[model samples]
Target: MPEGASHQSDSHTQREAEEEILAGLAASLGVVLAKPERVALSGGVFVEVDAATSDMGVVVEAYARQGRLKGAQPKKIAQDVLKLALLKREPGWERTRTIIAFASHEARNSISGWLARAAAEFGVELFVVEVSEELRARILDAQRRQVMANADLLADDLVVQTDSGR
Candidate 1:
């Protein structure tokens, strides 16, 4: 009820709202980003997506860091995705498809060079989307639903824990 406490709560809410927007952008792009049907593990933390049914196998892998929407290694991840795509004999993907999307304008600009390098290396495509105000709101709503669902699951867990403790 204190003024200071309310202000802090508001700040926290705003931060959460921002995070939800970024997550939504990522999720939306993820839906559009094509993936190979059979995701297989190759040695050295590599994954292969088999697109044998299509013209070429479009392999994709994501390297994520905690609290980082996209890491400094977009070029590397792009290269790996392209390599897998090529290994699957999906050259058409290189011409028709792109990999990588960032939630922020700054992040997108910072990684543009890396993205270009990777694209050139493998002859693949690249695209980036900045989080818009409307998209952010939609993402926040979806995130709120997810958070509520999670809270419900957590409440169930707490009940089980309490019963077990007794």
Candidate 2:
């Protein structure tokens, strides 16, 4: 398969997993949650959260990776934290419950150390929603495929260069 197609497939898998996690959370919380329309912030800026209750009382950003963070994954999670924190600063969102939901404990640990403390201090709650065994297997399988793909690229003398110059 082509490299671009492979990456797109991986991304699609991750997105589906995340959507599943959000659905599980909605069931656990007994509330219907959907992505709200872009929320207005100051200066005509707007941001969107992954899911929110109809009343906007609860907002969530979910991470569905089953393993530890890799590459820019940590930064991605931090960005979610930042989004939720900024949203909370909005006038009517001050009381909104901001949560960062995780599909696995390992993914949750990506925020360990000072970042974790900072998220808590910002009133960002961390929660883990259990995914089914089959979903868990699928996530693990995708992760393994991703790792192998990276290895294969490196072995093919592709001279992979990251933007960070790593």
Q: Best candidate per lDDT, number?
A: 2
Off by over 4 Å in 2: 2-9, 152-166
Each prediction's whole-model lDDT (CA): 0.45, 0.85
- Candidate 2 residue lDDT tens string, 1-166: 7655556136666777789889998998898999888777898998888889989899999888897888998888888888899989888889999999999988887778877987998899988988888888888888888888778878665554553366
Q: What local lDDT does model 2 show for residue 144?
A: 85
Reference-based TM-score of each model: 0.36, 0.84
10 residues in a row with least lDDT, candidate 1: 58-67
Please give the range of 10 consecutive residues that has the lowest summed lDDT in model 2. 156-165
For model 1, the stretches where C-alpha displacement exceeds 4 angstroms are 1-98, 104-127
Which candidate has the top score in TM-score? 2
Tens digits of lDDT, candidate 1, 19-77: 44335434654532334554433443444531222433222333221122333355555
Whole-model lDDT, model 1: 0.45
State the TM-score for model 2.
0.84
